[model samples]
Target: MAALQTRALSKSYGSRLAVDRLDLEVERAELFGFLGPNGAGKTTTIRMALGLIAPTNGSVEILGLDVRRHRSEVLPRVGALVESPALYGYLSGRDNLRVIGSQLGRVSEKRIDEVLEIVGLKGRDRDRVRTYSMGMKQRLGLGIALLNNPELLILDEPANGLDPAGIVEMRDLLRNLAAEGKTVFISSHVLSEVQQICTRVAIINHGRLVRLAPVAELLQDGGEFEVKVDQPDELVAALKRQQWGGEARSEDGLVITAAPDGRGRSLIKFLVDNGFTPDAVSARHRDLEEIFLTLTEDPVK
Candidate 1:
């Protein structure tokens, strides 16, 4: 069963559609990335997924149970850290967890300790939340979500306010969670981090999905290759002659063009066959940020 799924899920505030038939499925144990620009209805979708707000149309399923119909049973199996965790500043970190734990029912002292350690707030759990840094507070919030040891985690901007080290730690922690067979769905503007951690990604713009693909597949920009050749200009001229290589160009002392049959070996053979020995040949990769901008900038139909 899919850990989380949305079938034509949509939400609107009167005439304005915030989310439009957004369909997505995150398989069990998958590390999934949900990406969008500001005002793209990501939060609205999340709210509906958590059953905080009902969808205007369609439905959401968590672990194969309809969220609207089985909210009680579905919510317990899911842990979420939304836009910002509501935390009492005056309370110590451990006390904060203790308080939320009470509402979660039967959370043990050992489990609390484990959550603190997992979120990297072990020794500092005694510190007041008011005195903690933004990153520390974020960790504490994540700790609260983890108190129940949920099977699915849905997080929004989890690395918000985190320092470089904190970001790396969070990345490692999330990877470890997925490795241990937990499903993690993350919504964030941090494209670089998402590229590294998420296996599959879904991008939405104008409340509609524009792309859904594996990170590797999304980064592969039409099988183009970057070749460091001695005669870049000559190579470009020769490549542009072929029907498959009409888009060939010389950029930054490199011959940039699509490979013959989208294979590196074929491109290498072509180069050698055409008397243009390449110093190096590598498949060109587009940055996730670049791809994100390209997809979201154009309004989805």
Candidate 2:
């Protein structure tokens, strides 16, 4: 069963729709990224999935159990830290964990230590939360959420206040969680970090899902198809005549783009069939930031 699944999930406030027919799913042990710009309905969708808010038009399920019907049973297996984590400024990090763990029943002192170590806060476990750095508090919030040893972790902007080193630590921690068979679902606008940490990503823009693909596939950005043909000008004219958008450089030959749909090879075959000998063909890959911009900048269907 998918760790989490949303079918036609949607939310609206009066005339404004926050989410629109969102169909998404995450597999077990997958470090999944939910990406979107600010105000793109990421948090709204997460709230609906976690049963913190009701969807206007659809359903959400966790491990095949309906979130609405099995809230008690499903939520226990899920842990979440949304936006900025709330911490008790006065309480020691260790004591804070004890306070939260107390609600779930007799949380052993040993369990608190284990979580502190997991979050790399063991050295400062006794320090007041307010005295800790932004990175440390973020880790502590994550530790609090881990008190239950949840199977599915849903975090929104987990790296919000983290510095470079902290971000790296968060990334490694998430990878380690997934390694331990925990499904990690996160929402963020951080494209590069998402690319580095997540295996698969779903991009939503203006409350609509524009793309969903593996990190490697998304980064490939349709593969830059560059070739040096014997007749550069003729090649340019032929490509234009065929309605293929490509540019011809004076000294460098022709530069074209190929999506995963095999358009590049078709172009090559068309050139060969027309008796135009080509010197060579090569492909270049794009990074995640570039791809993210292209998706969000275009019109969504």
lDDT on C-alpha atoms for all candidate structures: 0.93, 0.85
* Local accuracy of candidate 1 as per-residue lDDT tens digits, 1-301: 9999999999989999999999999999999999999999899999999999999999999999999999989898888999987799999999999998898788999999999999999999998999998899999989988889999999999999999999999999999999999999999999999999999999998899899999999999678999998888888999999989999998889889998888999999998898988889998999999999988985444
Give the poorly placed runs of model 2, Cα more than 4 Å off: 221-223, 226-256, 259-281, 298-301
In model 2, the worst 10-residue window by lDDT is: 243-252
Kindly provide the TM-score of model 2 when superposed on the true structure, using C-alpha atoms: 0.85
Residue-by-residue lDDT tens digits, candidate 2, 128-170: 9999988888889899888889999999888987888878888
What root-mean-square deviation over C-alphas does model 2 reach? 3.5
Question: For every model shown, what is its TM-score relative to the native structure?
Answer: 0.95, 0.85
Cα displacement (angstroms), candidate 2, residue 34, comes to 0.4
Q: Give the distance in Å from residue 87's predicted Cα in candidate 2 to where it truly belongs.
A: 1.3
Candidate 2, position 231, lDDT: 79
Clashing pairs in 1: none
